[model samples]
Target chain A: MRTALRLLGGQRFLVAPLCLLGAVIVFAASAPEFLTLGNVSNVGAQMWVLALLAVGQMFAIVTRGFDISVGAVAALSSTIAAHAVNALGPAGLLAGPLTGLLCGTLTGFLIGFLRLQPIVATLGMMIGVRGLALLVTGDGQVVPLHDADLASWLAFDPAFGLPPADWGAIGCILLAGALLGRAVLGRRLVMLGSNPDAAHLVGIDTARTQLRAYQLCGGFAGLAGVLVLLRAGTGLPTDGAGMELQSIAAALIGGTALSGGVARVFPVVLGAAFIQAVLTGLDLQGVSPFIAQIVVGLVIVAAGFLEFALRRFQGFAFHRRSWT
Target chain B: MTALALPLPVRSAWRRWRPGAAAWTTLGVFLLFAVLVPRFASSGNLVNVLRVAAILCVAACGQAIVLVLGGIEFSFGSSAALASVVGVLAVPWLGPAGGLAAGGAVVIAIGALNGALIAGFGLPPFVVTLGMLMAAAGAAASLVGGQPIDAPPSAAFAWPAAGSVATIPVPILLGAAAVTVLHALLSRSRLGRLWYLAGANPVAARLSGIAVGRVTFLGYLVAGAFCAVTAVVLTSRVGSGQPNLAPNLPFESIAACAIGGIPLAGGEGRAHQVVCGVLVIAMMNNAVVLLNFPIAAQQLVMAVVIIGAVLLQNAGSLPVMLRRALTRRPNA
Candidate 1:
């Protein structure tokens, strides 16, 4: 029991599961329909896009920076994918991730080699990508998929109690986990974020690591874009306007330190799930969507407070242990 | 030694008169627009450009204050929206003047709350402001049912936005006044120095007994006051309360500061820099409209200009690096 307590205390993402549990309990009690299998499945299906985006965001945040251009990049990728699909059949879906890779590469070059501030560089990319999305479709017209039936089948047809898209998202997330946890490049990213001077002294290529992190971030956003296309059966250039904030909120709530160098993929996915649950629960209760937004925002701040409290608690625990 | 000594005074003199990269860029954009776009150089169009820039400039003054304190405010857009909603709602009970005052108070109160949370709890300013942004926007939307509410037309209410004193538009005058006040606060006051010190190095400032927390709180509060002024003017101009009013205010203000060559890393900015940046953006926007470009081209052009302008600010190092590379090749 003491060992378990110690383990829980040491875990950075302890709050994510706790928060998720608390939300579920509160929602299940307040709304009788909250725990229904239909709603559960509905939320599970809906959360994959956010899950992918948040996982991607983890890469950037772990590098002590963030990319605010993900939503715009996703929208742009979706538009490109839509056009490609129309021209080359369903095989054209590859266009989305590729476009995202190209955009990410540009942003990475600016931030890495050119030495621009991450926020500023990403802000520029956000605007430029949004413009590109609009320009391609002739002033923000939605591009409908030619193969809507196939897209819907992949998005909604349940296989092994989960849609193909959800399975794909889970696969992508686990791959991200492996990359972040086991790969040398991931260690370099964390090391650079934790202490740039030390990383440089140890001969880590800080610039290249940052570039790779952003590339991963952009690539994930592209995958999210593709998911969006699959679900909506259309390319929406303006759809992801405020999604950047939501993804950041999810990553933060998942226990990714804003000060950098700490993250876990599973907890971050749980964070995204918590957000979806809140929105879904609030919707079940007939509350306005705006109120849900407010709750989500408050939850983000609460997450920050939780982190602060956890740090204080750990300090107190350390003192107690040392005294004993 | 003689050559170096001779150039010292000349360099100092040049520094004294030399416009910053932002200022020069503003001038160049202005000249380019004047030449390329017909009717852009007309006095009427110039006034229109300034008028449009006026609101952005006022809000950007608030943004500049927060940036100098090494913090960012994402709630300005939403807070302005909330203020407008409250202002219009209070109009039936409170007179127009009172309504406006109430609206200003709402913004100030929100600012004070943000200040208290950040100062008291040691919260990250970004997280706190972003939370406030969401909550405030939700409140605004809920109050008005996500629709715009029009205030009963009144001459007194319109005066703040429409009234001119001796051929000067009120917003322009207000914008200039805001710049002047910011200049005085940043350069002439003790609190301003504290802000700079705290922003540059908080631990050092704290160790020096500077009360960094209080300085930060006051900075955000002052920023709120500036935003309140903007909200009031915007409400008056539109003659209605809009839940989505000025949704881009925060981004635009931050962009203005960036374009003006104010480092986001904090510890340095000037009033003239803000004006120059605002003018550059305003002129670019005006030229885009005047050029009759497709709607999509506007955002594309804006994207290029923002990146290009920021790149230009850092261009001073490029030439030096190039020269170094050239010099080293011969030795190799």
Candidate 2:
């Protein structure tokens, strides 16, 4: 019984998910319309974007690096997509995903090859990409898309009561999970993150592994941006504003260790959903949007504390003994 | 606190001039801007740049101290916001001195809370400060109803920013005074050595009988005091208590420290390096504005410079990091 209780309190099963459920139960009880089908779909739509970003965030976090520039990449990708599609028609659709891929690859190359610290490198990229996005838009105006059919197909057309964006998010998560779990490259990346010195001794290509992880992260962020553009039928320079923080919060809350070498898909996705649901509930209750931002920030710190406490309780000692 | 004086380690004077690259780079960048951009070399623009750089320098001063101790205060920006808001609002009832006290008290209280959590409870500095950032911002918003508070009609309020001593702007003079005190504290005082020792190796420092927790706590306190001081000056300069002010200050301040050759891993940096960094960023901003570059281009250029500076600073270690990854060992 004690063993079963211990197993039940594991990171994968408890902590974040319970907090999420607690929030949901409290909010659903308070707000009558929170559980409505329409509201549920609305929450689902919001969850998909953040969910995608969170999954991408997990990749970077697992490598002990942060990709704050993901938000900027999303903004740049959407703007580039809007311009390309306007100029070349359907071929522009290819521009969105490709832009994301190329941007990710570039970030990976810089971080992996140049040995730039993750936070500093990604911050530089974030600022640069955001600037480029604004430059493309000119005067911070939104880039309106003329491709209505594409927009409808990407965002509005729902099959089996779920939109294509949700499907895309699910697909990305599945693909990422498989990459992290089943692939040889993914295992090497984990080992690289777990102990760079050990991995080096074992002849693991740490730099290349870092490159692949960041590239994948960038790709997801870029794809997320394209989805946003298609849904809104416009590319706003500020689309990715505050998203980097939100994604970081979600990924951390989902239980990805900041020191790297650990991640879980379900927790990350659920973390994103929890955040979205809380925001939705707050909106329904007429709380200020700024308060939501505060809540998100607090949630991150709270989750960190919870992780520390859970680890202490579980007595699962790792290589690094110090919690802080 | 008195035990901080019990430190003696044989060291050369070489570490004092360690951040020479940043200082030299500032000079090089200044010359480039002076030649390329018209009016950039003019005394009027130069003083204006100094005035602006002074504010960032003060904030970065605190950040430099924290970095030297292997911690960070991400909430400095929000701390300034809250201080300015409370300071301004309190001026009408408490007078200028009282208002300043109120602001200082609030910051000190927040600092104590941060110190307790980080030092006593072993919470990570970044997470604690990040939470503080949001909470402070939210408090400021709710307190002031998201509106800018005008400075109280008092001579004390106007004197801080408007007054000058012997042709130097008061802000510049205050900035100089701050730098002098901080530099002395970090280099000449025994407390500074404790910070360096603790940051360099916490376990060793503890083994050497240093109260690492107390030192860490004091570092946060000192950082908070500087940030509070910055808020006071910013409030006086702008002549208002705008809650929205300095939203991006912490990022720029951290970037300044990084460019000044302060390692994020900590245990090495000086007060003068921060000033050098602030000047570099200020010159860049001045150049962009003078050249009439688009806002977008300005941001891009600033980002590029920050990355370039960090890369240059870490250039020595790059080869080692790369070789570690590329090296192949024989069978384990």
* Chain A TM-scores in order: 0.95, 0.93
Q: Which segments of model 2 are wrong by more than 4 Å?
A: A1-9, A316-324, B1-19, B152-155, B314-332
Chain A only: give the TM-score of model 2.
0.93
What lDDT is reached at residue A210 by model 1? 79
Question: Which ten residues in a row are the worst by lDDT in model 1 chain B?
Answer: B323-332
Per-candidate alpha-carbon RMSD to the true structure: 4.6, 4.2
Candidate 1, superposed: residue stretches over 4 Å from native = A1-11, A316-324, B1-14, B319-332
Candidate 2: deviation at residue A245, Å?
Answer: 1.0
TM-score of chain B of each: 0.92, 0.88
lDDT of 2 by residue, B189-271 (tens): 98888989988878889899999999989888888877777777777777777777687777888888887878777688888
DockQ of each: 0.40, 0.46
- CAPRI-wise, candidate 2 is acceptable
Each candidate: what lDDT?
A: 0.85, 0.79
Q: Any residue pairs clashing in model 1, and if so which?
A: none
Per-residue CA lDDT of model 1 for A1-324, tens digit only, reads 778755544466877788889999999999989999999888889999999999988998888788889999999999999999999998898998898888888888677656677767888898889889989999999999988998999899999988888898899999998998898887888887777778877877666677788999999999999999999999888889878888988898898877777888888999999999999999999999889988988988898687667767667442110000
Tens digits of per-residue lDDT for model 2, A136-252: 888588888887787778687898777776787788789888988888877877787788788877876777778888988888887788788888898767788778777887887
Best by TM-score: 1
Error of 2 at B24 (Å): 2.1
